[model samples]
Target chain A: MKISLNKKILDKNEECAMQNSEFFADNDILCLNVISSPGSGKTTILSQTIRDLTGEIKIAVIEGDIRTDIDAKKIRAAGASAVQIETKGSCHLSAQQVTGALMAIPAAGMDVIFIENVGNLVCPSDFVLGEDLRVVVLSVPEGDDKPIKYPGTFAKADVILINKIDLIDYIDFSLERVIADIRVVNDKAEILQLSATTGEGMENWYNWLRSKITQ
Target chain B: MHETMVAQSIFESIQQLTNEHNARAVEATISCGQFNPINDEVLNFAFDLIAKGTPCEGMKLNIKHIPLSASCKQCGVRFDYDVYKPGCPDCNSMEFDFKEDAPLLLEEIELEPN
Candidate 1:
């Protein structure tokens, strides 16, 4: 006998993500899920953003890492309330874990909550952590081919940040090629170039964040 | 890898289907999108590791790869293509909405009668 199941494998995660989305909407909070390859400057960009927006907009962070609380500590030191989620070797943060992290953090008055996902372009793209915006960071040193190599991540990004632009003169990275490739996968994604270290082009990023909050 | 989690979900779904029908699943078919980053070889290895010591042990796993397709929002042309080339061939427009053709689906299960 043959039986047809025809069911989605990740339906459980999808359901939990939907619940978290509803919860965020009810609280009037904007949640951003940040994903990228390891050492792509997700933490640095986040720390800088937090510092720039401190006191003006209340922000909280949920840091997802495979082992340590290093990023969480950095986020806290930068001024936002932070909670760490150690996945214990899991490749990605599931929706269930984010739900728990949201409950643990002091989200009462937070205007924005950033879920810094584990630094893996492949796996994190598959999991949704109930976010209003999905941001993918690509550093200049990582080359212009990442969007084509990891299309899944770039395809799902609402915003793509080309970080470490200050090194463009020293490195052989082609900004035009990167933007063209990203456009091939996702035509509507907002692409920005910025250097979190020198703070150059960061105003565009900050302005984009503000626009999202207002929307 | 996360393939283990995906395999576990498939195994659990098979178990539930078997329980409801009062039969044992002998084989299962799964379909996934080309855009999905799942490596079929890795998925099979993970499935075997997870199916051990369970009712789904030794069941044959079959996978169907679905090519990505998109409908051009600008020109209203529907076309199928590889993940490497996401732009529409007819209009050369990147402005398009892709079809959800590559979902990981537990398509069917062949069962043994009680």
Candidate 2:
């Protein structure tokens, strides 16, 4: 006999994510899920944002890594509380794991919470961590055709940050072509070009982020 | 690949349902959306590897790859998304949203009483 079991495959994760979302809502927190490939400057962006917004907004981060707490240490040094989750080998951060981190974090009076997802463009796109916004970072060296190659990842982003723009003059990268490609892949994503190293065009990113957080 | 994790999640759900019904699964049907970014062969391989040595061993798996259906934000026309260029077919506008009823679904399971 055929059993009609019309159920979501990632039901467990979805349920956990729902709970996490509600928790954030009740706490009046704005959560951003930061996703990118390795060396896409996710850590640098977070550190800069934390330092820039210090004393103005109370921020914290949930750092997901493959095996080490190095990123978590960096986040703490940036003046925000951080909870490190070592996935051991998992390519993505699941909603369940985020829920655990949420419990571990002292979230009181926090205006913003950033979940620095494991450094992968593809895998993390499938997993939702109950975030208010999905921020995707694509560096200049990664190529202009990346949106076409990882359409799913680009399409899911609420904000697509084009990082390492300081080297754009030296590298064989076309900013215009990348912007057009991103528009094709995701018309809704707010694309920002910045260099974390030089802090060029970072104020736009800061303003965009500030617009999202209430109070 | 995260297909291993996807397969494990699918099997966990199957295992739970099988136990609830007190039956052995013969086959399972799942639907995956185009935007989910899962490879069919890798998903099957991972599922099989995880199901091996378990009661779910030898269970047949069927996957339905679902394409994206998008609606034009400008002209209000609905069309299937083109992988090459996902803009609205009628208005040629890039501002469009796709319908993803669910990214992944375990539709049906064929089972037999032991």
Candidate 3:
């Protein structure tokens, strides 16, 4: 007799997500799921955050991409243990992928673990990787309407970093619009505007990450 | 799943719904909430195509768009869709209990068997 495979697929994913969450809790590790649209500085922020917090605390990074280990390379270059989760065809990273990456990284001894999600604004918000915090990035080049346009991702974020602030003068991103739109979805999200390239406003993000680990 | 994969799933949703119910389905309804990243326009097209060869061919498919609604575990205020920003609208607290469950639910099946 053939068993129903579709239902099993969903059940497996849920089980994996719960197990991943349990792993994070048992180890007293703080996992951060960082999501953003393509090229919204998810990796760059990971790079910067890793660099700033590296020596002060032992941090590791898990990079999720449909293909390539480029982001993982960047995170590794910034002096941290990095692992890559290649989803291949899956648009978003599941709890299993994240947990698999967690196995690669030494999260038990690390201060913070940043799981950079696949660069899609839509699907990753659905699966939870048992992260202590969820950071969503929106770059200046991505424009202001992203908050409301991809509201689900934004609404799920613990911190909204408006990256690429160095190019604010050159772009059409409206802080007012992003703020207003974010307010409609998440009334009290901490909005931090910074440029990972220039490191102009990187302190707030680092501070936030530190605060989460401390708590 | 890629964009095409999701598109295919939408089509599958329409086909599976009809197959589970009947060959000629009338007034079929589906619900896609704000949380699910589904392209209804494409889903509609997929539904039309799927319905063409099946019993529910040419049957009008209706979709009910569900909004995101969550309640705060601490404050008990239900919030919806905007997951990126759900600090309580009333308390200005960042911790909100989000009610974004399964977005694509086949709520009710309508079939007219001949």
Q: All models, DockQ values?
A: 0.64, 0.64, 0.12
True contacts kept of each: 0.79, 0.79, 0.05
lDDT of 1 by residue, A103-156 (tens): 788986788999999999898988887899899999999988999888888988
Kindly indicate the candidate among 2 and 3 with the higher TM-score: 2
What value does the lDDT take at residue A181 in candidate 3?
A: 77
Task: Tell me the lDDT of model 3 at B19.
Answer: 65
Candidate 2 has which clashing residue pairs, if any? none
TM-scores, in order shown?
0.93, 0.92, 0.72
Which model, 1 or 2, shows the larger DockQ? 1
* Deviation (Å) of A73 in candidate 1: 0.8
Taken over the whole model, the C-alpha lDDT of each candidate is 0.88, 0.86, 0.73
lDDT of 3 by residue, B26-55 (tens): 655556656554565766676676557666
Docking class of 3: incorrect
Looking at candidate 1 chain A, the ten consecutive residues that score lowest on lDDT are A180-189
Runs with alpha carbons beyond 4 Å of true place in candidate 1: B71-78, B85-97
* Candidate 3 lDDT, A54-90, residue by residue in tens: 6787888888899999988988898899999888978
lDDT against true structure, model 2: 0.86
Q: lDDT winner among the candidates?
A: 1
Ranking by TM-score: 1, 2, 3
